[model samples]
Target: MDEQALIPDSQQGDLNAFNRLVLAYQDLAFNIAYRMLGDEARAEECTQEAFFSAYRHLGSYRGGSFKAWVLRMVTNACYDELRRRKRRPVIPLEPLNDTDEEIESPAWLASSDPSPEEVVHLKELDTAIDHCLSTLLPDFRSVVILVDVQNMEYEEVSSILKSPLGTIKSRLARARQKMRDCLQGFEELLPSEYRHEQEGK
Candidate 1:
């Protein structure tokens, strides 16, 4: 199915067409929200809200990447949630550690069938990654999640973020650097292969 056609149809009040588009991108939207907020239930709520917001504003979408357009709504929803969280501060169970560095070629981005040992290791690594992600400021976190975690290109990220290309690049660069530095402290927790995956890069 052509995604472009569905966009115009959705704009014209085609609920069925919009539903198809939703089915296609819901996982992406949810994952983004989950990554942004770090809470499953809140992520679900934000994703649903974003889709509703997207539907209401469908007519305002000029032709471009529909995925990015949908994602803009998702990010906005996530931003709103984060702002709410700020207003209701809570005591931290863990502390944040800040640092800097970049990883353009992350080995973890590779897909594969995992062995039992690999599976266990991956769970630990994921937790470490999530912890590091949670420490980042929302803007930096969004850039990293979209570019590195979501494997989106900078142009699409800029579109989703509604920022200048240069600004996106800078934020992503800083975010990656921060992640690289933060993950170094978890070198013992992560596998040898995972730690060295981006050596050349």
Candidate 2:
């Protein structure tokens, strides 16, 4: 069934309908939370919280993009997490596995067909991008992630962030520029071939 149909059922207290919506957008919710917070564990928590909040507030949801509505809830949860982290900062120790081996990169970075060199290069690039994303102010980061990464339109992003369209565009531009600068400075860490490829672009 279309998610639109699911929404009304969900609002009417149908847990199965709501769960279908959850299955549809769970990746999106978790991805946005992750890109915003840069932590897998926290992102998972935020996604769950957003869904709970959404379920409770479904009665207030008038028509329009249900995906955007869900995004707004996820974004709010991330903002809350960011504020809490600021209030109680803690050092993050290196992650270790059951055998006590330090985990160099997240297992999610592994793929079935990539060569070892390809995997390492991809991980390095991924790290640089995440670092650049983390450096952005929350407002700028949200706009960029929603627009560039999530491929949202300006109007939808404006709705999600509750910012003016012009403001959303402006922040996305600045955020992209900052990411470029950060990554260019990080060229030393990437493979030389990848650096050349970027330069050619």
- Whole-model Cα lDDT of every candidate shown, in order: 0.84, 0.85
TM-score of each prediction: 0.79, 0.80
| Model 1 lDDT per residue over 126-154, tens place | 76677678778999999999998889988
State, as a TM-score between 0 and 1, how close model 2 is to the true structure: 0.80
**Can you give the lDDT of residue 3 in candidate 1?**
95
Top candidate on lDDT is: 2
Residues forming the 10-long window of minimal summed lDDT in candidate 2: 109-118
Candidate 2 lDDT over residue span 1-201, tens digit each: 598789989889899999999999999999999999999999999999999999999999999989889999999999999999989986555567679997676544333333444345545666666777887899999998998888989999999998998899899999989887766656767678868988899
- Candidate 2 lDDT score at position 19: 97
